[model samples]
Target: SAKRSVVSVSALAVGDKLPSDIKLSYFDVEGNMQETTVGSLTKGKKVVFVVVPGAFTPTCSLKHVPGFIDNADKLKAKGVDTIGCVSVNDAFVMDAWAKQLGADGKILMLADGSGTFTKAVGAELDLSDKGLGQRSRVYSMLVEDGVVKVVNNG
Candidate 1:
């Protein structure tokens, strides 16, 4: 169950760079918090950012994140510097969800609470009808040295 969407409007392109002003920090498995600034995370690197609508949901918990988790090694082998998972959830929930799905080893889960980063990247999807408020759409972005190369979204 993969969600797909055509690039409508100016959602994202194959050669856009990630905005460097925003910094993100989220909780870890041990309840300790770790904050990651864009400068430190994306400096001179290619990063893959995957977004999910919600955490612990049916499609997400069962398929979406796991798909990336399973394929992370292959992606890395292809020269990806880091793989990140983004969601509308807060740090604690994101932290726990990552561990539960065994994604901690394969991906870095970032909490996009307040949809700050979501709206910033133009990746926010309206799921109010589905009881999901201001959640991120199911999508993935390939970034080269911090510049966006391609964005696939639903």
Candidate 2:
């Protein structure tokens, strides 16, 4: 599938404060709705927020999501708090996808329908060629207590 908007993350790095105050919603694969508070999600432990252009895309479905989903237990053993999957889609879409991928319980699927959070983190992607406009880049960030620790496999 082609993407319309591409998203990118700029100037955010380790030790820098994250904008956890942003409001967002996400959906499970079963089409359930969920509203989330970033701050509360990162209350303690390390957080890994992974952003993708879409849920069922070739790369994301076959590799990206699997990498984290397969390694979720390993990360937890390392004291990691949570894993988030974000996209510029609606809560229902995200929710449905998460459930489809069995990520409803392990991963936090966040919806950035307006691209507000995606732009804030500088992870916006430019997918004009593919038709996904201004969506987040494929990557993951490790945040500790609302501060960035590292952006992995970006």
Winner by lDDT:
1
1-154: candidate 1 lDDT, tens digit per residue: 9998555523667877777767676766566888776557788888988888888988989988898999999999999988988888888888889889988768898887778777877777888997877787788888877778887764
Candidate 2's clash total is 33
- Give the runs in model 1 whose Cα sits over 4 Å from its true position: 1-10, 28-31
Colliding pairs, model 1: 14-149, 16-148, 17-147
Over the stretch 7-73, how does candidate 2's per-residue lDDT look in tens digits?
3345566787877778789764455566777787787758888888887778888888878888999
Give stretches of model 2 more than 4 Å off: 1-9, 28-32
For all candidates in order, the CA lDDT equals 0.81, 0.79
TM-score of each: 0.87, 0.84
